[model samples]
Target: MEKKSMKGYIYLMPALIVILLFTAYPLIRAFLMSFYEDYNMISGEYSRIGLGNYKDLFGDKDFTKALRNTSIYVVFVVPCSIALSLLIAVLLNSNIKCQGLFQTIFFLPYVTSVIAIGLVWSWIFNSNYGLLNIILSWFGIDKVQWLNKPKYALPSLIIFSVWKSMAFDILIFLAGLQTIPKDLYNASRVDSTPRWRVFWKITVPGIAPMISYAFIMGFISAFKVYNEVFSLWGGKAGPANSAITVVYYIYDKFYNSHNYGLASAAAVILFLIILVLTIVQRMMGRKK
Candidate 1:
């Protein structure tokens, strides 16, 4: 037994080594650097500034806006995506005709290129003569500016995100549904239990684990949303940075302004946010 365990450990060494080299080291380095002032990117020169970077970040209006936007996006996306995906999954799992076709149609968005989706959505959300507006015009409705204005820009992205993200979540919920024993439903049917009661009492509780997983995962992804905003609105965040997420803020700080220290601080804040949310989710799951 000892020798077998030793062999297993030896086999895992290569992957562990790679993780330490790439993931662990970078994270540790970044955390350490977050305490310092703008350390030279080209040269290895640096000066310690204590908490100045974080203090500045908290006070910065743009940073505050980015953080607020990220929080709002996460709040909207996580629960909405999970609920919609669960509904879709339930429908697809039911004894409906052409269910496989429906599943394929829903899952297509998940597999399709995100860049392509963003670009296509941009065209559809275009202020003038876009597909959605064209259709609205048929009913004599006015064409609302989808991506240009602040009020609609973030929501347009959120709508697309929820639709695209639902595919994978639907798959997960479907798998969870299958794991539920058929005997429970049979027993319910034998007792003439109402469908709604069985769903709420049996089906939902049985799938609680899946719901928790999806919620936590969606929350993290929404918090880190960047590429979608970038691709959707021609590289800029929005009309006036309405869609500037935390990750995008970090990127802008690092690339656009060459403020590496502030970027590191932002990254650290994001890491802490994700970590805390994950912990809270796990605690709630355990309580349930």
Candidate 2:
């Protein structure tokens, strides 16, 4: 048995070493470097700054905005996407005609390139010539700025995010729904259970695990949003930094400003947030 275990470990050695060399080493190095002042990205020289980097982040307005905007994005996007996807999954699971075609259409956004998604949506969201405003024009209402105004920028992001993120969750929910024994649903119908009760008591519990997984993954994705904003806003955040997120904060500090120490500190903070949230998600899943 021990020899067999040894052979198994040897089989895993290459992958384990790759993970250690890339992920673990960089993580440890960044954590240690976070205590120093901005390390010269070019020359690799820095001074010990203690908690100066973190302190600066707390005092910085853009950093605070990034945190708030990320929180708002996660809070709105995660649940809304999950709920919408769940509804779609249920509908698709029913005895509807052309389900395959409908499913493919819905899942296309998830498989499409992020750059393409952003570009296509940009035209639709254009303040002046966009189809959205064109439709509003028919109603005698003035065009509402979508991406170019701080007031509407975040919501525009949320809409685009939900549209994209819902596809994967829908697929997961559909798979989970299939795993549930059809006899249970049939029995509920035979007993004359109301539609809502059948859904709550049977369907909801049946898909609870899928919902848990979706929520956890969705929350993580939503919290770390960057590429969406970057692509949509052409490498900048939305108007007035409305779509700025913590990852983007780190990107600006490390890549743009060359503030390595502050970026590392921010990365550590992000890691902690994700770790805590994942743990909480696991606890809730176990409780349920």
TM-score to true structure, per model: 0.92, 0.93
Clashing pairs in 1: none
Best by TM-score: 2
Give me the displacement of residue 109 in model 2, in angstroms: 1.2
Prediction-by-prediction clash tally: 0, 0
Instruction: Give per-residue CA lDDT, model 2, range 19-83, as digits (tens).
Output: 99999999997897788875776777787658888899899999999999999999999999999
Residue-wise C-alpha lDDT for candidate 1, range 1-288, written one tens digit per residue: 344456776889999999999999989977877888868888957787599889989999999999998888888888888888888887777678998888788889888888888999989888796898999899999989999889998898888798788988998898999898988988999999998898899889989889988888888888899989998987899988888899999999989998888899999999999999899887987886
